[model samples]
Target: TELQEIAPKEFEGRIKRQGVVNALDDEDFAAAVRETGRKKLIIAGVTNDVCTVYPTLTALQLGYDVQVVADAGGSPTKMADDIAIRRMENAGATITSTVQLLAELAENWTSERGGKIIPFVMGLMPQQ
Candidate 1:
């Protein structure tokens, strides 16, 4: 309910599931991903070490391209975050920032999709 409230209307109908620390371990979550027929997955979680890393590694093994949004996930400490990020990188998950991910997705700033995304991303920047 909270997610539906916060998510954009278009994504409110997307499949969502509460699962174990490793999302791939949950049958429904894994199934939903497979149903999408997508090879690439962009993921963020409450914590990088436990919540993000586990599923990222598993997803890589399952032959999906996984990108972890570094700033979107947290860890108990900087050391923990660093190690988790390194671990995921070593296992072949691309570690990206929210802005970088958006740019990659949008591709061209003059495009209609880019025009929409650029404003949203710019809003996320810190004021000078």
Candidate 2:
């Protein structure tokens, strides 16, 4: 596929996680990432104080260089966001932007970064 040629190395896979507080297990999550042959994880979700933070924390504890993209994450209120960020920090989670993830994964302009990503960045920047 066209996109595959753009970033053949940075493939991602999805997994299903099911459990309650203090009951959720991360081995399966780790397995999914392993299945993709990646050592680092980037994730985001709602209710950042719980659903988002818990698993990411678990990932860090498991030794994955975890970065939670903040723009792709959100909470119901400012209080929730505050608590979520604090909890994630306590758990050793690094917060990063979506753009940062793109550049890291892209690695260089030889591929998609310059070819297919220009329009996307154009949208993020203020018009001249």
Candidate 3:
């Protein structure tokens, strides 16, 4: 993949890339998000404390509406993740679930896009 070329071979598939950033301050990532013309962002990362919080704070500072998917943003410990979530919330980032975001985008179940989206959403969600 393109990421394998840009990122070091050591990274391999472990890198979850929205855009390439080798540092905590990621101008390229911010620019990439801006290029998409998307003001609202859903942020997740392997280590929630540093990886997720840094970008979420940056996006919030840049006047973007940010949502941090708590479950998706894993941490070394639950305490660390909780702390990061609290910090993000304090900085005006919304803590949300993947399901909530998908539901918002999909809207009604009867719509054309909804037909496709529902199945995908169902796969993400457990039978209830």
Candidate 4:
């Protein structure tokens, strides 16, 4: 699997599973998340309608602060994507874009983390 093949060296020993559309439905994945002891979750899945929506709603119900990276996931159609976004928002998940998430994490461009992230983000932008 691409995920397993491309996982970074730091996550080598981490639990990585396949075959579950809703990741939270997998006991191992859910247990791993619980073990993290983190209340906030940043989630992005391949398909917004199924892979993303199901878990976002479940996480909200489970009392985790959820942020769905909108642009990171896709749907078969624009309408499907919009519907999924609205559903998640109504369920109390924060919908954010990739750039927005990076900025929120970096905070200030003058800071050490920002200094590195800004350059990487810029590289992703199209040159005009």
Worst 10 residues of 4 by lDDT: 1-10
Candidate 3 local distance difference test against the native: 0.78
Model 1 lDDT tens row, 15-57:
5666577988988788988998999999898999999999999
Best by lDDT: 4
The better candidate by TM-score, 2 or 4, is 4
**Candidate 1: which stretches are off by over 4 Å?**
1-3, 6-19
Clashes of each: 0, 0, 0, 0
Estimate, for each residue in 16-76, the C-alpha lDDT of model 2 and write its tens digit.
Answer: 4566542127567555567777777776875676667877887787787878887677888
> Could you tell me every candidate's TM-score relative to the true structure?
0.89, 0.66, 0.75, 0.89
Q: Ranking under lDDT, best-scoring first?
A: 4, 1, 3, 2
Model 1 clash pairs? none
lDDT digits (tens) for residues 16-60 of candidate 4: 778887789889889999999999999998889989999999999
TM-score of 3: 0.75
Cα displacement (Å) at residue 86, model 2: 2.4
Model 3: per-residue Cα lDDT over 23-102, one tens digit each: 22556544566778978888887678877888888888889898888877688888998899999999999898778877
**Model with the higher lDDT, candidate 1 or 2:** 1
- Full-model lDDT for every candidate: 0.90, 0.70, 0.78, 0.91
What's the residue-level lDDT of 120 in candidate 2?
A: 65
Q: Using TM-score, rank the candidates from best to worst.
A: 4, 1, 3, 2
Residue runs of model 2 more than 4 Å from their true location after superposition:
1-30, 107-112, 124-128
